[model samples]
Target: MNIYKIFLLISLLFNTLVLQAKEEKISIQLDWLHQFQFAGYYIAKEKGYFKEENLDVIIKEFDFDVDLVNGVLNSKASYAVGKSSLIIDRLEGKKVVLLAAIYQNSPMVLISLNNSNIKKIKDLKDKKVMLTPDARSAAAINSMIISQGLNLKDINFQQHSFKLEDLISGKTDAMGCYLSNEPYILDSKNIEFKIHNPSEYGFEFYGGLFFTSQEELRQNPIRVRKMHRAVLKGWKYAFENIDETVKIIYEKYNTQNKSLEALKYEAKILKELAQFEEGNLGNIDYKKVEEIKRLYLLLGLSDSAINFKLEDIIYNPKKINLTQEEKKYIRNYQINLISNSNFPPFTIETDNKLSGIEIDYWNLVRKKLNLISAIEVINNNQEANEKINTNANNLKYAFGTADYENINSNMSMSVDKVKLALTTLVDKPYTTAITELANKKIAITKYASYYKDLKKKYPKINFVETASINESFDLLQENKVYGILGKLPALSYNITKKTISNAKISGIYNENYELRLHVNKENRVLLNILNKAISTITDEERKLIRDKYNSIIYEPEKDYSWVYKIITFLSVLIIIVVINNRKLNKEIKKRKLAEEELNKIAHIDGLTNAFSRRKIESILELELNREKRYNRGLSLIFFDVDNFKLINDQLGHSTGDNVLEKISSLVNNTMRKTDSFGRWGGEEFIIILPETNKVQAKNIAYLLKEKIANFDFEIDRKVTCSFGVSQFEETDCADSLLTRADNAMYYVKRNGKNEVKVV
Candidate 1:
């Protein structure tokens, strides 16, 4: 080798050694087995972001025996990834800094079958519930029950089996499931289920939090920042390129055996949950942390958690400012904000103009953030629910999204600022105790917060649902319902206008009336700006806004003009009624005469009215019953027109019918008042004798046959019938007697036309 080339090779070799030496080794303790829940980390490793940052990061699954907090604290794991609130850890002196949030919206949800009546978190009392062993998820569950004035002791807790079979097999009534996990299994199988999200009821918590001990941040800040940067980059890539990331995960890092499709779905859901698509990739908001802590403290209110502030849980805080790219993305971009049209103070619409405390507050927030906004008012709870379900930020700030956006995956920042009360008639006043609501039919708006959840919580109350609070108020006024459940503004507004002086605001449910701002997971770039704007809201400003709306009196104009108008209308109605009565009397008289004629027509057969078949049968049955009781003789002479089928087929039914009519007239002429005669059916007739022997009936039948045979029928020239005389038998019933008479008639027809046969 030449001297210059050797020097260049030696320098290149040294540089390569130095680059290799610079790579730092770190291990992240993930909460569960390998899955797309950790897709960002997997993507970072696979896509070489960690390598780019000179990191030789080792990803480890959490062992069942591992203490999650101690793992990082004791250096068993350099960092830990978990889905929980870290308030407990910070209070316990673990001194962990939350580096970045993996999922902005927690994927944890309490899931039940579609048919299950359990609708809300409060409904979980006395029901079987399965929870993950993790403290964070369990703690949230406990907090929920506590919020409902119940304890964890009231619930039947089942240990999670880490498989959906426990839930599918009915071992658990409700199971804590990840939106990215068990729900996907149900969805893939097209099984319907209901997801009970805590955030929906104002118990908002975080999910997939990435953190390390404060010592890690203090000693190796560069490496910590690198790790945070790399993980966030991985999440961004995983969310944006979902398909490609799923391929990388499934083909390489999959230990949970999650299908590529499932991973893809998980990625799509995480984008909304983590707000990666919403441009909130790994951006930590300390205000959200504070909100979580405040809620937890309120739920448990333990002394340890009380000492911890929002900053204690977050490592290094970044100021609320957007980059040029962020500014350009949001500038002049009017946020599609949704609110309630009828909800007062927080949200109200007057003459199509939406102005309320919430609106005023959000407007101020918008001005601070330098963004324009368009407000959408949800008219009812249904609209409120559906409005927020979008991936877009709703005023409730909870979002519903498209199918591909993944349900239960939207970042939520709860503004826990409202309350609700139950109103009842003053005569039927109720106490606030849930138990006291037993046997009462409480009228609630169908669109009430956590409506299904309310159903689950208070199974005792028979809920009469109304579309609006006004409808519930009407129901309450009529004494049709025992009580009404609504916000203070709604209840107060409704009761004051119902001038009957019968209704009063009664019991109040201490539920979290927190309003939330829901941003689409795909459009979370403006969340920080919004949060910064929210932070500027003074306590005085909040009180001022609320007080103004609360004190506004809605005095319904009680003009008695309506009463005078009603009296005038009633007088006119009475005059019309009097004239109608006279006309009705005359109509009634005419109707009675027409009814008499109708009765006569009904009994007489139109074609051949020889007492009618129905009348003859009535006479025969009465005579037979009398014969059985008194031992009196009774006889029936049944006959059919000889060769009737041949006559109809050869001569046409019109001619056949004309011949039968002539025969019936001849038989009627010969009948006695003591006897009854009628057409049995087409081409057939029957005679009933009240007190006659078989021989006597035979003679009568022969006479009738002879008359029919000689009678002229216009079309057939002559008409005759074969006769069968049958006496009532001791054992004969209606059907048996008819059969015997029919057999004798057949015999007569077999012998010859116009002949008599007795049986």
Candidate 2:
């Protein structure tokens, strides 16, 4: 061999090395600049997780509407951090599909000063709130406002610059903030703040998702999956050893004052914030994606959108290997059939078939269990419910009806309340001035829990009973009754042009009812699956599905121009008539003014112009109604100023009011719209929180207590509130609820004022 042969061999080996390096270069674009929020990607890079996967990954920072999704679609990048809004973007024909969600819950929140007297999402109504012009925060706030029965136009918005200045200066009641960022700033500034996280209130959407083009998902799914696994490993490492990851981030960015301690704290927060349970880190909930899509549609954010089904968006968890015996057990188990009606939508009928959410859910359960049999649907609620009760041997496993009360004795049943919009209206003549119909019969399904209150409220009126909601609507149209109560969607469907057109909806009843699947005593296996399925279907998913098809039928506006002109003409013609009605008009105006004053007083805190004790009580009552009616859960917290007498003694009487007013304002500012804050007594306050359990309530209470203790009251005086929380129980009376909360508060008092106690 000569020198020329050695040179040729060396050149070939060098070329092969270059080709392998080219294949390994992978660039990923993130949705935003680097932070703990993107720690997983950073950790993966730093810890050699990506390197182990034989990948050289470059993570690019996205800025100023730079669509990384478009980069993926165009093959410029392999993957990117996709915002929850990416679902909306995809629906609108963008070529990106979410691969995984970094956060299980959305981190976007509405933050307010510790003294703005604005708490909860509902409090933003008719109030000024600051918003970022182009973020998911705006969409979330809008959706929240709409859900509270208020329109976007009802509230005023100031443009926010991602700072706490507007809130600090009291220019805006609340400012949009991320739970991981702005809250830390507020804490560092020693400024107390309240945060309203939309995710907690059913405004469900994914955040910080890993996304790629559908084409990429199809072409290189294995590579995509490998990336996901590595990303997850990185997240686990970062979560477990946050200090090291924070140091890496600080060193990489040359952030000298990054405060590794704060970064570690933020990491711990992110661990809870990110989706760590369902799959590894960065797994997107398909159901949540579908919900976000529906929200986008409702918000009118997209046009000519493709319908993305739940199956299309979610990344299914990796398949787990199972033994043959386990597979057989899953395959052979028979799900009981309970309900009868076979109602379309809830229970679809196609080619004499039956399928819907219930069917789909049960099927998923069977698939998960490796079961082969299908869940059977019965014809009527009575037959199914009755059969299950009467003969244990008839069908040990049956899916039937169960109300809140049905969960009592005699029969063992698992109840899942499906939230739906329901409304009712009396005939025009009857609604206006018909006395005879005041006592006339109104129809509702007999076993339905919604009827219990209506019947109790109007005991004197004749109650018309029906077997099903459809029959009740029919009876109303046939003049057999004065009013009909039914689900809002079904009622709206019946009054559509293709259906009955003569009927008109005049009134809406705010009743949230549970539609449950009752199981017989002997069928524990089927009941367990049913319970699991219900728990899996989150409140946000239910709301999204309900709002998706429940079309809003706007009534044609009345053309009152001619009528106004005629009335004006008549007014001129009948000067004497006008003179005679002057006193009446004055009285009416006075009454209107009085009513306005009363309404204001009802909502305002009498001692501090925040919210009154009555207002908080009313809110708690309403929340209780909503919880029971919807079969959801909530927490009520009672808080009292610890050693309030000390403050009064040190600062005089007027100073006490000022202190009270300051604390009252702080409490009001700290609560979410879903939370109601009111002064319960001289120095005691109550917070009524909807859709919150004891644990969340405790966390919120702790934060509040800490804020109150650290807050500056302008006079160098310090104050703190002791919190006592009680979760709403099924059969709990209002007094019992108060007593339990009082007990918890006393326990908090004994422990120390600046503490949270839960009952």
Candidate 3:
């Protein structure tokens, strides 16, 4: 052979060998230990789904203290099946980016044997439940309990080893279990069980998400895409061919105990849950992202870290495809507020009437400024912070006697003094008693700057950090601490006419701190409008509202022995009666009557004789349930008084109430006999148009808003209503349908409250 021909043959042979040697390798870290929950991944591995893709995938099970994303970041793994929230936390901590969510809803659930007879959520009251170590399921279960109006103390939670045997042996009435794992095991054993899905009870969280380091995403885009596609394909295959998948799982894991029947059932359940219609199989809905964020806030996971826009969190595998209209709408849009409620006098009751000084002041500001905006009066600082941080439109603003520390970037001495005074009032009354709060066993919210400073100054005080002002106050009321420190206005607002009468402002350590509005950065224009309005209002006018609503100043009285004796005696007597009766008949009767009255009061909005949220929930629940049962058409029409918050922020809650009442009355008067109406929540109200579809509902909602807008309220001004309408879906539940209606109302509020949006 010639020399050139020999060289060509050698080069071709070397290239062929290199190609054969290159088998693609991928690694996935599971969130927990090897279990049936991850059987699909194991099955895929053993069944050659990955091999078919020219990939060799390794499954790494995480033990305690093993950071999955850190492994991914360090290149030990390419992907992870963990929580989306954890992914978000990692992203915020600059650790990882989530690619897809393996489970659309969390598998964490409260499990009880059928024999336990724990039927409803209420049945868990006073029952001992087992919790796992550092379990996310525990938080979810607790949150579900709270949403159902039961406090954590209502249930006896005992920590248990991560074993179902404790529950089976009757050591605990119920135990936390993954719906995908333990339930399947129990079913395979023919052990009947009752499972409470947290998602169904409002503790919705996305679980089993596939996340990777940002560096990995950027460095090997093809690998990332291939891995996502392969995993999804594996999931699809496992779900469709369960028998084969179970065989594969058994071969790979060497597990003969879990039956094919159970594996098949679990695979089917996971497949239905993994379905996310947008982007891809594991794609997250940004709205659901916000919902989770709201849940975190409610759960006290972390202080609203960074306010994220919808676009920021949402991942599109096919990146940045936007139409002209979408681009324009998204770019100019403001963040939406998660929910709305009255802020003052104190938090508005279901009656929708203002009763405090802050409400009065806000009302005056609105009237004098001639401004319009929807204003929700939040009752506590934590709620205010969460609302301000999460509001998509950034329309939500915190107005009070705010501390300089709350609004300013840095803490000056004056700000510190103000914070101290505020803290004195809100926190347990502390004597110049301790130099270090660490020694005092004081529990404060983790992210509260004031508490952080207190810890720094008085490290000796035993500071217990909680998640929110409400929790902090709850701790204080329990006498867990000497006191709390806070800003003056919020402190003053919180202490008025509530329990905690023994609490008082120990001293005004700082007087120079003036209350200011904490406007979200995105809503700077709205802030400017507010500032201008504040500038125009005279000091006397401000004082009038302040005096009217916040006039009842609290002062701790000297303890008297006789008074204490009488109070103690009364308390003992009440306790005896309560324990003996156990029925809570009077309490239940009072609550039922209160609910009925609230319904009536809601029907005629307290301010304008319009419907209220209480009414809305009641009417909508009935109508929606009826619609579902009968397969009849029903539509929800949402209406909001335009610039309602602006009115509250500018005028005061009193004036806002006036505007609401006025608009509400007009709506009630304008409504047709067939229209069923009630307050949606906060500034929004809904009219359930039974036997009507989307088109008719849209027309009705708009007409009501228009009529209210054009009505001559003669209450020294003009106000308008915004409308949103949606027809009930076949799959719609109470909360989901309301959320859709709320989204529609938000659409109108965003576009201009006087208009109507149909979805």
- Candidate number achieving the greatest TM-score relative to the actual structure: 3
Q: Give Cα-based local distance difference scores for all models.
A: 0.70, 0.65, 0.60
Candidate 3 TM-score to native: 0.43
Give each model a TM-score.
0.40, 0.42, 0.43
Summarize candidate 3's per-residue lDDT along 131-220 as a digit string, tens digits. Answer: 644353334565566656666677888866667788887888888777777887786678988987776543456767777876775555
For residue 131, model 2's alpha carbon misses the true position, in angstroms, by 4.3
Query: Model 2 over residues 138-158: C-alpha lDDT tens digits?
Result: 346556666556667777877
